[model samples]
Target: MAVHGTVAAGFEGVCEEFASFLEREEHDPGAQLVVYRGGERVVDLWSAGVTAESLLAVFSSTKGAMALVAALLVQDGVLDLDRTVASYWPEFAGRGKDGITLREVLAHRAGLVGIDRGFTREELADDRRIAELLADQRPFWQPGQFFGYHGYVIGALVGEVIVRATGRTLQEWYEERIRAPYGLDLWLGLPESEEPRFLSTLPMLTTPEQQAELDAAPYSRFSLGGIAFNEHAPDAVELEEFVNARPVRAKGQASCGGIGSARGLAGMYAAAAFGLDGRAPLLEPNTAAEFARIHSAGTDLVSDSVKQFGLGFNTIAGSFASVAAGSFGHSGAAGSLAFADPRQGFAYAYTRRRYAYPGGAAPENAGLLWSVARALR
Candidate 1:
């Protein structure tokens, strides 16, 4: 398979590694990888079925963008991290959740994963509807006592807080403050004009053995993990189908409704951490440091896996040995990963059109990221 796009002279290894990964794949992953080294894009590469400009649905990676918005508000004194979420959104106080702080929510410890009945596809597309549905529901755990990957509803939970505090939605704030200013293609809400650029994410192609493993795994619609992903919903949509719908893209649910390319993902982090195109970085050093600090580290009750969360982002260093300890970003269900390593002075993003087996930051990222890191070093 032929790879397209250019890499900076020193980063030829990243391009080679990307090509090798694609060559090994049994199918076209339709992947794109972009790296920014301190405000300068050092690598831009894409595999077959996608161009650098093609926008793809990046699942939980959307959470990173949401977290960035929250960090901005916290930095601007518009939202206080320590303040109880109920203090801003009174309805959120229902069901013994009055003490959960904004900080805890960002750390995935607020325990408002999803409603017991689950959400319809339409409800999942609308953040306001989701917030209303969950406001009075019971939390799965004691507030702030443990952390879990909230998966689907975290954005609505956090977005509700944003609405009550700033009188605006997370998508609005993101467009005005982050996406528009930086001209980043990463979008909280994708407009119709941009719709033509989006390519629907393809499903994972698993082997018979892989299918058997998936089938054998314990899963129930009512389980914590199931509910977190909204599998409990009567009209639940598959992860790929959820974002493929036009309504979901238009509303940009904030959790997994994000649509963008590797450039857009890399640009957003670069703008936040290193400034893009000569503008000053959107986040101050202290702000970036605070968000990147590991807030939750342990076995996640929902996913039942050991994970490290820095605010809303996965601590990239923990998952990828090549990155620095302070690195932070979120990975998508479709094998996309994007983050900034402030300590190492680079921002990196990788997106794949086809879902990778066993999901969440495709295994290829381990080698690809290592190549990028090695080049930088």
Candidate 2:
């Protein structure tokens, strides 16, 4: 297999396997996989027309980034995870949301699952509009009843809280505190300057008939799952287009629109594992431990299976047991995955330009990642 860049110390084999996997998969147009051990990058490899400089839209992997920012605020006393959401953003009290806590929101237990109504691209850009819809919308389930993945709404809820606490958008706060100081290339809200460098994600492979079945399915929780947004809305072009637009981009919806190289994502997890590179610590050891604590573990109402969740990160068990118990990370919509194992003191990130099958059950990608981690162990 051809290796494109430097591999972390003692992890060259891991990168080799990763490169080979990408080649064999073929469906992956481009990809970057990065691993860090003991606060140092041990496996940083790019292959198949991808490079360290390439930026891919990592779907829900953005949630981990959002969680990191929220954890930082909690550490700095800027926000309290246990506090009621209404305490900070009083308007969140509307629509029986007075009891929702930051912990619940992060854990996907705050019944604000899906917006009861459709939102235009204009509404998505308007923070006030997003918040108003959330405030007025009824919960899909009783609050704290069960976990329903907050697909798009999680970003808005978390972003609104961050704004109330810091008076800065999540993107601004993240760029200034996490991205710039740490020298990371990740962006929560992409800027016009970076737009040219952005790689357009390949469209979903599902046929129109498959998409129709997905849309008509009663259990479909993610609004973006199967419907052709542009055709339905007329104004929306593609899901990515709406997600990456300036207004929505400015809000930094942490659930969907994070753009960065795998190295950038891995580096952030590495910082959490080993502290910032010779600078102030991003998270205390105990803070990281707390962040990794399991908050919910059961059949996720949205994902339709028993999965584990911490405050903002997801825990792996059963079928995902390959990832280890203490390991913390999140998987994006398609196949993007980012994880950090404190036990091994390793952080790993993988991103692809193309969308694979929806559920990451295949052995090619997830198996390859687990294989690399196992090799290091």
By lDDT, who's the top model here? 1
In candidate 2, stretches whose alpha carbon ends up further than 4 angstroms from where it belongs are: 1-3, 125-128, 206-251, 316-319, 359-363
lDDT of 1 by residue, 37-124 (tens): 9999999999988998899999889998999898889889999989998999988888898899988988999888888888888888
Model 2, 205-247: lDDT tens per residue?
Answer: 6667867875785643244231212123435455545554556
Colliding pairs, model 1: none
* TM-score against native, each model: 0.98, 0.87
- Residue pairs in candidate 2 whose N, alpha carbon or C atoms collide under 3 angstroms: 8-42, 8-43
Model 2 local distance difference test score: 0.71
Provide the overall lDDT of each model, using Cα atoms, as 2-decimal numbers: 0.90, 0.71
Worst 10 residues of 2 by lDDT: 224-233
